[model samples]
Target chain A: MQPTGSVRPGGRTARTKAAVTEALVAELLEVGYAGTTIERIAQRAGVAKTTVYRRWGSLAQLVVDAFADTAGAQVPLPDTGSLEGDLRELGRASIAMLRMPHLRAVFDVVVREAIHDPAARSALTEFFAARIANGAAIVERAVARGEAAEGTDPAEVIRMVGAPYYARAYITGEPLDPALADRTAAVIALAAREGLLLR
Target chain B: MQPTGSVRPGGRTARTKAAVTEALVAELLEVGYAGTTIERIAQRAGVAKTTVYRRWGSLAQLVVDAFADTAGAQVPLPDTGSLEGDLRELGRASIAMLRMPHLRAVFDVVVREAIHDPAARSALTEFFAARIANGAAIVERAVARGEAAEGTDPAEVIRMVGAPYYARAYITGEPLDPALADRTAAVIALAAREGLLLR
Candidate 1:
């Protein structure tokens, strides 16, 4: 029988993958990236250690696969008719996402891994670069409507809008109120419209 | 002998603190917080283990003391005669500080500790709060000179100016260019002048 879309776990391979990723996240929160081992992860997932070793080949590959399987990295682009509105929505979503524990854990893993490993650092950098590239569509639309400067770099605008929340969260460990989201959006919008975020 | 201004390490206690702190930083980079032990720190510092045990009861206190002894916490306030100038100087300093290995280590310890420890989180929050309060002086000067809105929160201006650099450094792990400092200052200055950084 054909497995309908989103209706089933599909097969043994899919089930093993899901179990392994779930165990990976749980193990990450418990022992962190440095302490994670294929043996423990396999045992936690009730999968054969040989299968895990053969599939991943290395701890790095396993960790990367786990992150790829996590749902947190995917962020939606907003189209609210105006760049300001889109920015505001995106800013609010960014804050909300950071506050969510599971999502935050994913980022924490990436950040923690990047701290000591060069390859992890590059992976983290590339992941955000891709997201930033995708987010540029919002600014391109704004440019089309003459809401932003023609010479503006779209990624810069996204980075500017998202900076405050990320900075305050990691640097100060402060509580991020909803009001901050709005203020950041307004500030970024003003800067974008004023031709400040140029390439 | 009476202590003279800028004479030396002050006394024996200061010397011990300095040595222990330095050892702590080295151990941190090597073993990280989870792996840090008082025995290893004392042995590395060439200090008596008994002295370390008696002086700082717990690992937390020792870590805090190390941060206190760290020079990175002391950020000089720039009195550039205008809010714009002061903010620009401060922003550039923030970027440069992150790039510097020793200074970045100080912040990374704080951030990493705060991730798993509640007390460290409070201290991190309060330390930045105090810095923000002191930074408010810049905004106050601007407000008095009618360069900014009267209702503008001074700390908000500082945070706004500092946000981009901190966010990009940690999140993107990108190389911060000097040009970003100028642009950040200009955008923040425009916002402040336009009364965007409200209370």
Candidate 2:
């Protein structure tokens, strides 16, 4: 079911963009990147082909926008008063986001494209850079509170927190459990305290 | 050029298999997975279609075999007497392997296929399992020599050693530098000493 007659901030234009992005994601999961086309997405979204073309311009741009939209929807950073709590929340949120089938499908395509296509690679780089910046803020708060070392690089710390879980899930094909999130948080916290994440 | 007159240990069959596998890698790099076909591979390998079919049986199997062949040719684990030294060697070797254009192309295809295809997933799982097992042996040697904690999970330790570098390479699209390898080895060694890698 599509949302119609919605009175929002950006009105019909925002609704139309949302509809098309949603349709793009569905098309991606259904037929994969190679089979996904602007025509099919426009048809699925019940929007005019020209509208889809005028808005996104290219399939690569559309795909990148869809990925960015999904990533932007992730839960905001938690302020649980401690570095450990913040990292645990981040890890849990990451695992939860990755568990969604639609999101995982979109991410799989993005990662594959990022490896091969320059546009996709740059899009993914920008997306993660934003996420990493958010993660850095959490580590900065921890440092100010004296929970972590002074010189610990926030971005590097965030990367360490994520690396093991991602390596297991994407690379080694290991089963991702809640315990992994906890262990990842603990390992990063320990490494941070030991000044291993210093720039 | 095709080698016709070579008489080696496994002779023509082995040589033909190697040639076909090599051709498959080249085709994968040139046209990617979707464009690679048995017909083209057979042609490029200078072998008949029937020969290719009868030997590898399927394109999936052929791709898996090619990955296996390349992985098996990696440098053997170093016995540097210390866990840190062995891990550094492993990290350096992994970065070097991932830097090669041909190997990176093959790995990219395998990783993408593994995400979408059941057969490729299984092949990749098995391949990584073998690699992790080798890394475990190195850790086990360290444990025996008291370089690491007694109860460390060797596989987990190895995963820690690889996670940061791979997360940067594949996830965040960060540059894979020598410093990353050294830092990864140091962090894992620290984590191992702290008994964080215990099962």
Candidate 3:
């Protein structure tokens, strides 16, 4: 029976894809990526196994898609009328994302796999490179607004803001904290004021 | 059948334990911690399998000992008449050690294992905490000498100096270049001069 004014088959497919994606992420968080399987995803999503296979070629592809799918729209660069405000907001948002337990687990799996898999490594690197560039753009905007000095290395500047969190997260195995975020932002802002990178 | 100057059979056994420890580290580098085994170590070191069991009760214990055996003395804080000189030397030495692929492989195994094993994680944390304290002592000495400002958060200061190279190694999956080390040292020195952190 045809329902009147029903959307096209493409809409149904898109819904299915979204359901499968969410299910994959949920399963990943629950069971970990190593323990996740296509069949399990099918069971969780209530979708046919064949449908999952026909859409994504492999489990790695599915996991990668699931990761990329969860990335939020770039946190709007804080334009609170000042560069420091903007940067502080950016740092807070970035730290918040890194602190997410589910995402951190996914990051752990993907990065561990990346050590042995060239393709995964490339994908992860490109993903971060773009994110770093997006962050640099915020710093550049600040410089344009005269909040930051001219010719600041935006990538390096952004790196400085994120470095402590990543170091804590991956090295010391400590949770990134809001207090750290504030201190880092303060340090970077001071460095920016002095144009510390410049000779 | 002891040679002249051999104390006793027990002394020979101690020699075997030292040989086994050295062999374990070499094998860990060659095949990673996961692939290493007590029997393989005995074969490689030409020690009886019982010797390994008698000294280290488990693989984890053996690995902990091997790691302890291999770690050199902490890089001495250079008071080369200047804080910059001291930190730069420390940075250079750290870069040299971390850049060693064999050491990094062993480190990667330990870190991954630490994620799943509480005992390993505790041991690993203790190792790093001690290392951090050692580095902090150098900064403290610098402050005492008036080369650096007093009340500098030495741990945080060291983090700032060392974070970039490690971020590259663990996060970016990039090589730690000598040029990058030079620039990082320069930045840390500049920040020190500006009293970025209280001594």
Interface RMSD of each: 2.0, 1.6, 2.6
Q: What is the TM-score of each candidate against the true structure?
A: 0.83, 0.85, 0.77
Residue runs of model 1 more than 4 Å from their true location after superposition: A1-11, A26-44, A49-64, A71-74, B1-11, B26-44, B49-63, B71-74
**Which docking category, incorrect, acceptable, medium or high, applies to candidate 1?**
acceptable
On the 0 to 100 scale, the lDDT of residue A99 in model 1 is 85
After superposition, which runs of candidate 3 have C-alpha atoms over 4 Å from their true positions?
A: A1-21, A31-42, A47-62, A71-73, A145-149, B1-65, B71-73, B189-199
Task: Count steric clashes of candidate 3.
Answer: 5
Q: What is the DockQ of candidate 1?
A: 0.45
Best by DockQ: 2
Q: For all candidates, state DockQ relative to the true structure.
A: 0.45, 0.55, 0.30
lDDT of 3 by residue, A55-165 (tens): 776777776656665643464656677666666787788688787876776676666556445666776776767677877777777778776778888877777777777
Q: Residue A145 of model 3: what lDDT?
A: 77
Flag regions of model 2 displaced more than 4 Å: A1-12, A27-40, A48-61, B1-13, B27-43, B48-62, B73-75
Model 2 chain B worst lDDT run, 10 consecutive residues: B1-10
- How many clashes show up per model? 0, 0, 5
- Tens digit per residue, CA lDDT, model 1, A12-53: 777887888788778877886667788999999999998888
Candidates 2 and 3 compared by TM-score, better number: 2
Model 2 pairs whose backbones collide = none
Error of 2 at B175 (Å): 0.4
* CA-based DockQ, model 2: 0.55
Q: After superposition, how far is residue A72 of candidate 1 from its true place, in Å?
A: 9.0
lDDT of 1 by residue, B1-199 (tens): 4223224566777777788888877887788766888899899989899878777776777776566445335677899888778888988887887788765765676666666567667766777777788788888888998888879878888888878887777777777886788899888888888888888
Error of 2 at A53 (Å): 5.3
